[model samples]
Target: MIEIESVTKSYGDVRVLDDVSLTIPTGGITSLVGANGAGKSTLLSVAARLVPADGGRVRVDGMDVATAPGPVLARRLGVLRQENAMSVRLTVRELVAFGRFPHSGGRLTAEDHRLVDEAMAWFELGPLADRHLDQLSGGQRQRAYVAMVMCQGTDHVLLDEPLNNLDMRHAVQMMRMLRGMADELGRTVVLVVHDVNVASCYSDRIVAMREGRLVAEGPTAELMTPELLRKVFDVEVEVHELAGRRIGVPWS
Candidate 1:
């Protein structure tokens, strides 16, 4: 479990996260959903230790993320930021291998190589393993980056805007893969997503934030109501039940 207690952050005079506290349970897909500037990405960054919070603390499992050793924390928590840009040129395979750094310290043993290969095959990137990152399409590159995070073999995976550059097909594919990771692999997946319908379809839990505050959070079924959607997004949403799932339509 990830415990965030009274977490706060600010940029100059603008406060992004205001005494935000959320607990993400062990295994399942938990999506942080809200409007732009709702501090969804900022909260994720604070939990992952990518951004230092101005106040409060975060703990993963039982270890304090603020004081844990770098390798120890990296081995337990894996993060994929929204903007992934490699400074140097690297092949798909090479980039995936970087996930093993915490375990192998740059010297990939047989086991590390095996896991890297498995991750590539899992994401259907085997054919493009030798291809450079720049050679692949946006969706393909996103898949490769996710594969790297999964290859890290961590218990918790936090992704910020995993569907950013993908088209409709790729976006669905990415959500399905993430759902599989939670259901099949039993890895805890937490992500920041803009599409509430997508979250309603794939996520087990939803954490809704607005204006740097957590508006609501609960199981997908419990939180998908039109009333709650209105409170979170400040827009009148018509929720319809489709194939045993509640989908929010803001246009209605």
Candidate 2:
């Protein structure tokens, strides 16, 4: 479980996360949703230790994230930030292989190679394995990055904007893959996403933030109401049931 205790952060005089406390249980997918500046991404970053919090603490699976050793924490938690950029050019296979560095220390063993191959095949990247990152489309690159994170073989995966540049089909595929990861592999998946409908459909729980404060959190079905969405996004939303799921439509 990920325990966030009254975490706070600030940028100059503006607060990005305001004493936000949340518990993300293990073995399922939880999505953070809100407007652009609602602190969803900031909260995720803090929990992943990509950014330090101004106050409070975060614990992952009973280990203090702030005090845990780098390699030890890396072994348990894997994170993928929104902007993935590399200064050096690398093939898709090389990028995926980098995920094993914590376990392999830059010298990949046979088991590492096997995991890399499995990750590439799982994401349907076998055809593009030899291609450089610059050579792939945005959606394909996003998938490759996610595959690298998954290849880390961690129990917890935290992703920021995982669906940023995908078309509808690939977006659906990505969510399905994440769902499979949680259901079959028993990994805890937490992501910052913009689309409420996507969160509604794929997430086991929904966390809503507004103005740097956590305003709502509950099971997917309970949090998908139009009132909660409007509270989070400050827009009129019409929520309807579609194919056994709740989908929200926003209006100006």
Candidate 1 error regions (>4 Å): none
Evaluate model 2: give its TM-score.
0.98
**lDDT per model, in order?**
0.95, 0.94
lDDT of 2 by residue, 1-252 (tens): 999999999999999999999999998999999999999999999998989999999999888898899899999999999998889999999999999988988999999999999999989999999999999999999999999999999999999999989999999999999999999999999999989999999999999999999999989999999888889998899998999999998863
**Which pairs clash in model 1?**
none
Clashes per prediction?
0, 0
Residue-by-residue lDDT tens digits, candidate 1, 30-148: 99999999999999999999999999999998888889998999999999999998788999999999999999999999999999999999889999999999999989999999999
The 10-residue segment of model 2 with minimum total lDDT is: 243-252
